[model samples]
Target: MNTPNQEAPAQNGKRRTRLIALGVAVLVGVGLYGSYWYLHARHFEETDDAYVASDLVQITSEVAGAVTAVFVDDTQHVERGQLLVQLDDADAQVSTAAAEAELARTVRQVRAVFSQADGLKAQINERQIALRSARADLQRRQKVAADGAVSAEELQHAKDQVAQLEAALNISQESLRTTQAQIADTRIETHPQVLAAAAKVREAGLALRRTRIVAPVSGTVARRGVQIGARIAPGAALMAVVPLDRVWVDANFKEVQLAGIRIGQPVELHSDLYGKDVNYHGKIAGLGAGSGAAFALLPAQNASGNWIKIVQRVPVRIALDPKELSDHPLRVGLSMTATVDLHDGSGPLVATQLRSEPQRVTINEQRDAEVQQQIARIIADNAGHAAL
Candidate 1:
């Protein structure tokens, strides 16, 4: 009883002192946090609503054929122009051979046309000489007939021979003109018939190359929709190739957050696959023109009775460093956390200028050089001369 009476006041005083100290600590923490927000944290706009994205290049067949072999499967890494599937090349080969043969035959036929022109010129010259001789002979016979030394029948025969020779020469000249019309101002290779046939050959070669479906871009193969012995049609989807190296992050930031964002601003990103320990460096490549709901399949009608204001999100494209991407690969649709630095001076809100240079992807398998070389070989072998 004696201890309780004396210690109660002292215990209350100690508890008050502890409470003061805790209050002071709380005040200092709040001040420090406020200072951080003012000086540092406010400069950055962060969002976890982001994803790794890249172009999903769809690979399709340009020629109809049955699948003979499947070289690549889903999840397999493929290089650009790597053979992914093979069609029943039997049909393609036959078509190619036929086209080549037709090209060769056309070249030969064109060569004959050129030769015929020269032959016609020679024939015209021969006919002209014969006509001149016939006219001279007729003149001599007419002079003899005036002197009564030539018979009337013989003179008439001379006149008829001259007339027939003139008509023959006229026919040969007309034939020469017709022949020249085709070969005029053009070489055998440049002739219309040969050009048309070369086009056919190129078409066939391209189709034959298409039978061996290859990756258009280097990356992992996905959505493999073909199998061995499956007959596929032209323009039908066969597979998809995604270039992981060229991936970028699409950060969906709230509409209010977009005010501070600008293109060309530096960005810091973290992938869910690599965790927060791994960091990625990037730059704000672009901003979305519209919000997610704006481009949605079923956009909300704010004018309706059920209207409720919802914060819309706009996608900001962040282009990452290729080297970092290589070290820590990110696949399409992977989750990411992106933090954009708003410290820099504001530029355009979004990318205003369209891309000056067009993105280009060339097929290594269907090379024009190879096709041209083959066409030249065919033309030379048949035309009896080197292709011009």
Candidate 2:
């Protein structure tokens, strides 16, 4: 059997060895964590609370009609100005035709008014000559009646003829003035009546063109709710077109983590769809004005009893590179992880202003040009040789 002293010394040494090993392990763990925090974590702010976003361009009918045909379906790619839907344009066409005919008829009618005014002018000239001749005849008859060379009845007839011719001249002059007033200071094309009819034609043309719904922008179709023979009204949400090329990411980070975050800071994003293999490079576009909870439908009442402090998240918009987006498309609402590099701390926390130019612009060149062409053609067809 071993002695008590030997047994006590051996047990003490074993206990000392176990304590030293535990201390070394603790030191190693702490050192590794410290290195990680210093080398990789501090220079960036990361969050998994992020998603892809885009402007959902809702396509609706400007005019109401039954859907005659649907050219696009859900998930189909469309180009700007491409026809996506066609309404039953029977009524629009008839209205357009009527407007055109009205415009033509009005132009001719205005021309006829001008002609009538000219005819009235000629009649007035003829009446003036006749009045002069009647007056001369009355003077001659009066002189000869005093010399007993003309009868009293004949002289009276000559005097009456002069008065009648004078009255007729006055009536003709009034008629000419009235007729000239209608055609004065205006051409056939610029006449008020023709202009009014032309406006109606433009309105009808716009209505007819609106019956064919075209894509406002190049994008992918979604939420298509229209079908053949379906009656739709103006402002109805028939579908939406999402521009994948112009998508951005909205990253929500905690309030505490918002420090040092600024506009123009470089950001790296990884979508859950592509994992970490595909990286998206972007820059901070701007930060949200307020936290989500602040704008929520039902906000928290912090002043009430049993109030618990919660971290609020503010959204940060990040614009992606267009070329990258074209190569690797990201759909709206896709989950993403964003890590913003805090190395460049020179940017502003809040954008004070935006660019002078608008981010999105709409042009009506084609439709406007078509309507202008139609108006010109109608005016030309009915304007005749009349000066416009």
Candidate 3:
């Protein structure tokens, strides 16, 4: 064995070798990381302050009625226009019947007014003929009176008859004018009174249809608030439907990170619901108009002296691919990690164009169409052959 001094030097040499190796390893790691960051990492920004979000379409009653049936519950999937609740429609039925009857009666009344016009026209013709005859008779009597062949009393009587016939003719003409004014410049369907009644009928019919509450979107139901026997008024919330397929991420990034972010930039998201195994690809849809704190219920008043500088975050909306969203559905409020690619920095800070897809209420149009058909049927049934 060597001396203690020799042993110490050997151990020191090994330790020095190990130290050199460790230093070289650390240097290599740093160089590799710097290269990777320069080549890849620096081109992206990441934030864990993100969440899966979607529109919570609330189902509300459009008319007041008592709930008679609840057809759906929480967590159930529903299709658009699917009936989800039913209200007792007895009152609606009564009101609709009354409206229909009123429309029919009004139609009949208008038809009578039109008939009176025809009768007035005939009366005017008759009065005109009688007036001509009397004037002719008076002229003949005046000629005879000049020759003293007819008495003055007889001539005066003939003049009085002519005057009375003329007055009758004027009255008939006035009656026809008054009658035509009521129905002028409009058809039976477009008549003022008829249109007014038809509006009431449509209102009542719409209320009746409103008694059957339907889902406005296809999604899973949540927050079911309706129950049997519950009296719900107009605009009362019944439930909410969440469309998972349309879910997107709301990534809140620090103001400093927003310098490179732009609309239409590609985003890679990892949901906490599936952890790091599953990935979602999307594009930046839009940037929020204001920071979250700016729009808070009670926004921070920086006018005070106790203000500490806190980094603000602005929400960036990311729209995911439909196929990816379908394959891996996301729920609202779920945490997510979003990484935005800044490689292609050629987009606007805000969306330049309006959304291509917009929410449309086709069901309302259908309801209105149905109401029109009903009005047409009512008018056809009541409008008579006496159209003038």
Candidate 4:
């Protein structure tokens, strides 16, 4: 219905309108993506410097012996107090027997001291009677000499008998003193000699217990170096214990990033091993003392270098739920990406105070009864002979 010129101009106008719409749509998309990058991008707290660490426990032998039996091999699972290795206990047995014998002999010696005290009392009584008789005989001899009924030499002999009796009495008193000294020695449980012997017994017992190398903690054994017949000594690193249950995550955040991060703040972590399928929730335990580079073996000599400024990261230890850790075990040194929701600003950014005592590892209540019973038995066995 319209002329060709009008129709051509209208069509051209429509084409121009469509092209403008397309350009606006493209711009809108670019703006949206830019906003997303600003909000959700990985803003790293700069560190080369991550380590896979745990409370590494190095197992060693306290008693010197040839390894008689290696019960658990490398990578074997071990429970707390379970036997891990056994040393040749023949030497320990001999030493322990010797200690027991010495302890028994000490007990008998102590008993003998009491017996000696009884003997001294009896000897003192007998000497008192003999001294009385000797005095009476001397008085009779002096009267006879005065009357000239007995010779002077005979009187002198009687006087000498009295003097000899007195000397014997003094010797008996000295004997009583020596016995009393022996009793005093027996009463001292903490005497140097007794203590030395008791210490040997304790040492021998400890050595005997150590022959059966029980696991100190429940964990998986790794890097075991000892085998049957290997002679081991004190402090020789034989293996390591890997505790998957007590694993904790260390999040390194930048100084600027620390503004929102605080103790007790809620956090969400995702590990590369488990991915986003399992989300680990945690709370900020505390921030590290210094930056990672500060603790380096050879710290940067920033004084003389070409001054290039770099941001530093400090490690923030995050504590995870034990239930979650138990459900899914995480190995030490696994890579993880963490995010802290800084919504709650209730706690301090840096802890101003510290605890006076160490936080106790929860006591194992299951073994309480058994331990009490064992202690009672030991007290009963050592009661009559030794007090403790």
Highest-scoring model, TM-score:
3
* Candidate 2 lDDT, 285-312, residue by residue in tens: 9999999999999988899899989999
Question: Across residues 40-66, which tens digit of lDDT does each residue of candidate 3 receive?
Answer: 988999999998889999899998888
lDDT of 4 by residue, 1-388 (tens): 7999879999999999999999999999998988875665433222223333467767888778898788888778888788788889998899878876675566556555656677778988898898899889889888778788999898888889888888888888898898777656445354444456566666676667777777778888988888788988888888877876777888787877777677988877777778889988888888899988999999978886597878988898888888988887788888877777766778886877876665332223323444344334433344354333
lDDT for predicted candidate 1 compared with the true structure: 0.88
lDDT of 4 at 312: 88
Q: List candidate 1 segments past 4 Å from native.
A: 1-23, 129-164, 364-369, 385-388
- Residue ranges of candidate 3 with Cα displaced over 4 Å: 1-13, 137-161, 274-277, 297-312
lDDT of 4: 0.73
Question: lDDT at 169 for candidate 4?
Answer: 81
The number of the candidate with the highest lDDT is: 2
Error of 4 at 298 (Å): 2.5
Score candidate 4 by TM-score against the native.
Answer: 0.72
TM-scores, each model vs. reference: 0.85, 0.82, 0.87, 0.72
